[model samples]
Target chain A: MGEFDLITRYFQRPAKRSPLGVGDDCALLAPAPGMQLAVSCDMLVEGRHFLSTVDPARLGHKALAVNLSDLAACGAKPLAFTLALAMPGVDESWLEGFSRGLFALADEHGCELVGGDTTRGPLNICITVFGEVPAGAALLRSGAHAGDDIWVSGTLGDARLALEAFRGTLELPADVFAQARMRMEQPAPRVALGQALRGTASSAVDVSDGLVGDLGHILASSKVGATLDADAATGVIAAAASCGLGTEILRTCALSGGDDYELVFTAPPAARAAVEQAGKESATRVTRIGRIDAEAGLRIVDASGAPISQRFGSFDHFV
Target chain B: MGEFDLITRYFQRPAKRSPLGVGDDCALLAPAPGMQLAVSCDMLVEGRHFLSTVDPARLGHKALAVNLSDLAACGAKPLAFTLALAMPGVDESWLEGFSRGLFALADEHGCELVGGDTTRGPLNICITVFGEVPAGAALLRSGAHAGDDIWVSGTLGDARLALEAFRGTLELPADVFAQARMRMEQPAPRVALGQALRGTASSAVDVSDGLVGDLGHILASSKVGATLDADAATGVIAAAASCGLGTEILRTCALSGGDDYELVFTAPPAARAAVEQAGKESATRVTRIGRIDAEAGLRIVDASGAPISQRFGSFDHFV
Candidate 1:
């Protein structure tokens, strides 16, 4: 029999009124009254995402958190999540730590650790998070429109730098290493700011793969382009510089490097004031770094409107 | 610095809620007024779950169906599901088939494939399904009580037999081979039976790992014990024997086999009439085989009510 036949025999059953259940361009979920649904998932591997020597508790937490960031990105409040944990052994300590980390995050986020599966194989962790946005109000990547200013909520590249430090590739002073490693170890999700942007911002996505990569998703999905101000784009480097690091290196890390977990979004020019207002209230900086363009590709320009040459590219999982 | 820390830095977000959101034991959603939520997840691995030579479409479909079976097991109405797919390459045809298979099931079940992830790896899939159960009506594994009857829906051991055939340990006529392969390739989820059992059964679970192993979970969770009639347990073997299989081999296969995708449930004494009525209306066989016990461990009894010498075990991922 054909694959579809097989899947149908096993998957299809009685259903409620979901317009597209299990098969469609995308599944649409309408949240309950006064509640928004949170959504998140993470991709993990043996060598690339983790090492065999790493603690399991932390691994569990990290796996759950990656998905949590997606909820943060959508500005949906976190609720519950399922974990898909693949491993070669039944390592108790690892499971204990992983569950600890996962539940710790769940506790903090007011979410629950519900369903999951444990299969045998190389270590791969994939977690899907569920959150809620008010009915008909979840933020999407396609809401970005031309003339909307692009903004990112936090410092980037610190995670990548920490990765370097962990790998022993880039040397760091004690203080810088501590801070950078902290950024890499425990990323602070911008859930508060994301909630604030729900009605105010037009398009949004979490910075997962890298700034350029996630931003490109918004651009392509929205059928718009962007021109980043290199100065603002490299503000992360400036912060690194103030901490006695090379701006160019940190800029490269911020641009092309990933694991940032920040929210990069677009708000209409009219909403820029609201963003500023939100920044003041949240005590978190939301920098306007670029503007959506009528054109269909991305470009980087200086304040003077001159294009800036950069070597950064999107994160390619296959490549 | 470590992998887990690295992951958490990017993932944890704040939980906001209606009923089930992000940080709970499970995500809850009321897609429609008074409708229950469907829940399921699929886990895929590279070498174990699928062979590189297998059609990607089939792989994807199988991935989706496995989780849908979980929802079917729960007797909840299907709604939507999320997928986590990991691959080493991006093959358009593979993705096309995978999507086709997935969508076909979704369409048939009125479920929408709401969200998913694509990333680089050794190829693993994890899908979590969402469905709904009327308030206070979700079927569980712990509802079986003393004097309640044990039941299983559909044929069993076909998937395990198919696996054997795949490994070339078993030889069959081409038609039988095809049938066995069909059993493996596409399993019929007992959605109708599960739903029918919701109001009538005391406890239930979809048979995945193996009857014994999966049933162990029910017993453990329900904090109850069971005494299976070995003769009735071997009834499937007798059925196969009439179809030309040897009794002993068929018995072993039925006992230790996994991947049947059938629902194994317990009906309370008071619900027996309801169970038979529901089964008749649903056109699904509900076998009566055993009874729940006050004891705290599973027991296998012969036709004369004496303990059998045969050991009971099922598939374990680790052991």
Candidate 2:
């Protein structure tokens, strides 16, 4: 199919939130009064972001889900998104599966596809998502205070465990691998938890490039440090329990394993009940595994608050 | 350098307009009251949108320019943009030149770089640009009316001429080829003209995929037809005069050559003076090239009212 035909057949839809949709030179979206538009972009490349053998449907889901994770971090309501896709060729079955998975999640969040581009090239999926948050209400990374309790919504590090298993660096039984692989492929963005923590959380960031590194972003931006409970951190990864992972490997994956789309946020000690209420409200597990400090750098600690020696570097795309 | 460092060094800057910029998971942009956001995305793949031999700076400029051209078509004022880029590896010199060109055009248009993603892959540049226009005031392709005088801003098909020269399909003198190449590399978006023609022009579109094809979009969207003056269209190619090109080649390039990025608009016959005034206000040349009709398909004719004997097909990415 031609570019326009391909767009029309698979991607184009009747836009609900936008004034103008996919066919126009520009899509028009009007944020409601007292609302600010929250925008974020993510690009997924084959072999870098995903494996070549990945299901097209899951790839599409992960593409939008990662972008949605940004919105979740910001405590914003998703409004619309633009997907610019480049592919080696057009495969009808792949497009069908991809679009199905893409629109399924988008519809769940009420995020309309507003505008995008399709071109023939190496497989790449670039998505820019738009969301709405009330003025001055977004959860920013700079809001974390020294006395705030660092909380992580949902689990982490399972994706990285799956990656290591895929790379043959680790081994897992069939059932364990299946579960870990599912976590790697389909991560649920904690949108409800993020919104619930809009006013409660002092600061927030989605754990994309591992919890330690992403939390470090909050620390750096807020000019505060954190003392992370390494043992408690290991408790978040479900795969570790099934696979009988060792302490060192679990610590490594829990600290440096990337692609976890969970939110790592901070709230004051007095608001612990409020944070627990938010977790219940969103129906997502909330784990308190760290504490913000006045110190300058992140310090890893055990259950008894003793410092751990091993250093972990988070995943970096260019590096 | 790592991904974060690379972003900090080359892409991140103090955002002038956005509430939050690149450091965060999402960027926040608040539009003025009664304004609607205009968004569009374009993906440029190596060997598809541009030649690999082209300068990185110009490639960056063209990447943002094409997206801005979409905003211009809708008579939207530039706001902010997100760039999602993937490349084989990190090259400092290329990033320097690319960022230089990107920021130059972005600064000119007052468009802030809000947020984006960068990763390792085959070369691809995906940019999603945001603009704002008064609610219900965007010039849409569906706004055309029968008997509206079709107008084009600046010149068209010079980029196509340069492409033909590069492809060994046409010959041009050294100076002419240089001038055409500049047009190909740096086609300035008509932002000012689009803003000026906000109310004056009935309908509008940017001619990226040749005048005939792009104009066909307007005609199809408006459920109308147009009689394009082939002779007048031929007069718009600057390279024709410089190279002493034949009428047939001139017509073909003028009609079907892609990458022009000039505005093709429709205005009422009585709005002729207003159209001219808009062009003058924006310091752009306006040429009357056609007239909208009640019938449905685009009809090309000479100044003498005779239908052009030759048929031309617009450039399609996939054949």
Candidate 3:
């Protein structure tokens, strides 16, 4: 079948929520009246974003999931998305698996696949997701203030733990590895949590580049520093304790290993009750591991409140 | 600098027309109330869409222009776009040139660059553009009637002529080659013409994959056939006559050579005057080259009304 036919058969669906869908020059979406449209794009390249042996279905899910996480960070309601794909050649089985995984998630979120381009090239998936938010209600990275309590949804470092296992830098029991692999391959986007925290969270960002680095973005954008409770941060390591990682290794992975799709947000201390309510409503765990400060740089404090001096780097595509 | 820094410095601009711009996880755009969002995506891969030697600025312009053309065909007013780019390595000079061309066109159309991802990989550019159209005003591909006149804006075949010359299959005067190359690399998106033709045109599509192939989309969608005036269609060849192409070559190039980025629409005879007025207002030439028919397949008739049997193929990535 031709490329267009393949897309129509697999990716194109009756865009029930959109004004128009695939098979046209452009898809049409009408955001709810008085709402602003939130748009973001994310691209995944083979070998760079995923292992060569990764399942097509998981890859597809991850591709859309990452972009959706961006929407979640901004407290936008899932609306629609477009997928631009490039592949070395046509493979029906691969396409089937990929589309199935993609549509499954899209259906779950009601984010209809609208329109895109497919071409012959190295495998790359680029998705642009559209969502909606009330004017001035979006959770931005520039809104955190001094004395705000910083919170993260869900545990981090599991995806990084799985990556290390894949790279043979670490060893784990089969069941433990399986759980971590699930985190690596299919990290859940905190869309509900974001929407729930819309009014309470002063600033938010998804932890795609490790906790320390992603949080750095909030600090830089908000022009505030942070004091992280090292012991509380290390609580993420308990999820990986079955793999027998030492404290130093666990700390490194939790701080800088990357690939976690959790939401790290900030709110005033007085909003702690609202934040907890949001977490309960979203059915996601919330952990307060830091506090915003007026100082210009990040500081990690030990259990005794003694400051620790250690540098952590985030993943940069060109670095 | 890192990839994020590169994007901030080169791509991030104050989104004057949008609710929010590039720094946030999702860019927010609020179209005029009651307007539907028109969205389309196009990806250009180096070595497939353009030669490695093509100017970075033109390559960037073409990447966004092709997507803009899709919106134009839908009769939408350009609003905003997101760019997802992957490249083998970072080059500051190349990026400078590319961003210059990209922003120049974006500024002209008032389309803001919203948010996107940049990663390390083979050079590929995927742009998703958003536009606004009044409810039920979008020119769709399924609205053509059998008696409607098939019309094309601007011209065609020049881009194909340039491709052939680049591939060393044809010879041309230096000046002619330059002109054709410009047409190939920098074809203008007919945004103004598309908006002007909104109420008058029944159905429309941009001519990207040659006139025959793109028109086929309209015919297939509208469930109609067409009878083409071969002589008028071949008039596109006159523009390339200075390139020393033969009649057969000219006909093939004009009918099936892709990448022209012109608009092809169908209108009822009664709306011909309105179509002409739109053309005049947009300052673009519109040509009526054929008529939709109730027959099951496309047919070309010569000046004397004799049938011309020639098969034309559209450019397919897989084929």
Candidate 4:
């Protein structure tokens, strides 16, 4: 047994209990008439998720945003949240900026800041978000079906590329660099897209841990397989090429990087046009990348219809 | 600015925003429609909150119980929760016991297990609780009025006494020892008493950091003062005398030692009987030991009406 198993053992069986239980970003709760509650939590450690040098405001925003992304995954409308903050010492400006950024997003989402605690410790932030969804309708990763199409919202790998830029391993044109940094510093949680897909999406998950790995979640939960057309994903690179990003670098970044906070969802063949229409209505773009299959493995195929050998993995904390 | 202020500066002003906001155990949130939400969070460090040798099952129960105590303080009904756990390694039996204990209370309270994260680190357990109360009905620390009769549900000092025994600083009689340890290991959150007191009590708080200290929270929030009758509190010790506890030790433990998890609330003098009657209906005992006053200081008076002095402070993370 691993530590996760220990934690798992302590939890009630998710299957017989909650519609969505321990493993998801937040639980889908329908406690009363007409209203559904979405609850999610995320924790950011000092060294693991961010460097000490990162702006405190960005840290705070990221902490809340990560949790909000969970709500986005469930198509839950943001309602309110509590913050549990632990820090070794107080820094005024850092907190001001952090709270400013957090509240900016929260206010835009109509999320109320309710209750929380501030304690003395090494810096860490734990945020619990509560939101509401329509009763009897919530998106889940397990709803993907064979023959359904897979779609990803927004571009991927920009956040990862930004990290590489921060680490001095990657260089890009100034405009592309600014765009990559924006993807990292301020991620759009795909809330509108998720809400649009509430009735249409077969299965959905936010791509925080890279595209292939997160898409793997959909396949595993749906008990199906998938074949991805690399060119379709590389289309993001084609779009970035106008900003002077190398297609190869863009392809690698879009495929294997993490923390994009975009929604990757599956829809039935017939629902594709409707989904695209919904996205258009919301002024958001949707791109089709693959199709769910009856087989039991994931394979990425090139434009020539041959399997690509390049490996893909996402950010795993204890891997 | 201190680290707390620095971090908090980023957050928008919580004034008039939360019925109960930052710095409380759980946040009190008013969602749309019928129910208001009570939310609280607690984190237990490996060495600070408990010993590694302590039963993991008890630790899990206490972790959840402590947070529920916060909800209980606000007179809220339990709804659901999320747990964020960090541990170095997995121990199957320990995990089994822990989860069993956590679920036992959750089942009893009808609080569903919602969402959580499991990761590798030094042992820590952070649990956030969500509960509901009717709108505008949450018992707050700020509602006590001058001349209000202050009452406590259940006895106090048992948890602190148990800590003494656990540390080998004191030896207690067998039944007394068992009772105290049980108080420490499995605190009973006063959920029933809180719900029962909904309309009658003007102000309320749970005694986690000892009577004097926790009551001070009520005083500060309400901007009222209090005079505790030491003799009446001694009467509680006399009640415990049947269990073999001395009055002096009990008084000190009750006043300064923490972790009681009992609700200390204030009601108008005329409502005393109603409060007691409600307690009777719920089968949870209520004891009136003090009164809210117009002045702004805390005083503990002996049976003869003389002040008693003590050289102790409530629990502080940093001294």
In lDDT terms, which candidate is top?
2
Error of 2 at A175 (Å): 1.5
Which regions of candidate 4 are displaced past 4 Å?
Answer: A1-33, A164-181, A237-253, A281-283, B1-33, B89-93, B164-178, B234-250, B316-319
Number of backbone-clashing residue pairs for each candidate, in the order shown: 54, 0, 0, 15
What does candidate 2's lDDT look like per residue over B1-319, in tens digits?
A: 8898899999999988998888899999999999999999999999999999999999989999999999999999999999999989999999999999999999999999999989999999999999999999999999999999999988888898999999999899999899889999999999999999988999999999999999999999999999999989888888667578888988888888889999999999999999999999999999999999998898899999999889989887676
Q: Which should have the higher DockQ, number 1 or number 3? A: 3
Candidate 3 regions exceeding 4 Å error are none
The candidates' DockQ values read 0.17, 0.91, 0.88, 0.13
Candidate 1, superposed: residue stretches over 4 Å from native:
A1-36, A51-57, A164-171, A237-239, A243-248, A269-273, A280-283, B1-30, B50-55, B167-174, B237-239, B242-246, B269-273, B303-306
Model 3 C-alpha lDDT per residue in residues A212-264, reported as the tens digit of each score: 98999999999999998876877865358666778777877788778888999
Model 1 lDDT at residue A74:
75
Clashes of 4: 15
| A130-240: candidate 1 lDDT, tens digit per residue | 777776566778788889999988888887877787788787777787787666656777777777887998878888778887898788768999988766866854225
| Model 4 per-residue lDDT tens digits across residues A1-319 | 2222322332223242222233211222224456566677777777666777877667767877877887777777776676666655555567667777777787678776655555556666778887667765667777899999999887777787777888887776777778877778777877777788889998888887788888887887789999998778877642255666565666677777778888888999999788998688767778999999999999898878898877776666555
Candidates 3 and 4 compared by lDDT, better number: 3
DockQ measured for candidate 3: 0.88
lDDT tens digits by residue: candidate 3, B134-219: 98999999999989999989888889988899899988888888888999988899999999998899999998888899999999
TM-score of 3: 0.98
- Which structure is stronger by DockQ: 1 or 2? 2
lDDT ranking from best to worst? 2, 3, 4, 1
Residue B211, candidate 4: C-alpha displacement in angstroms: 1.8
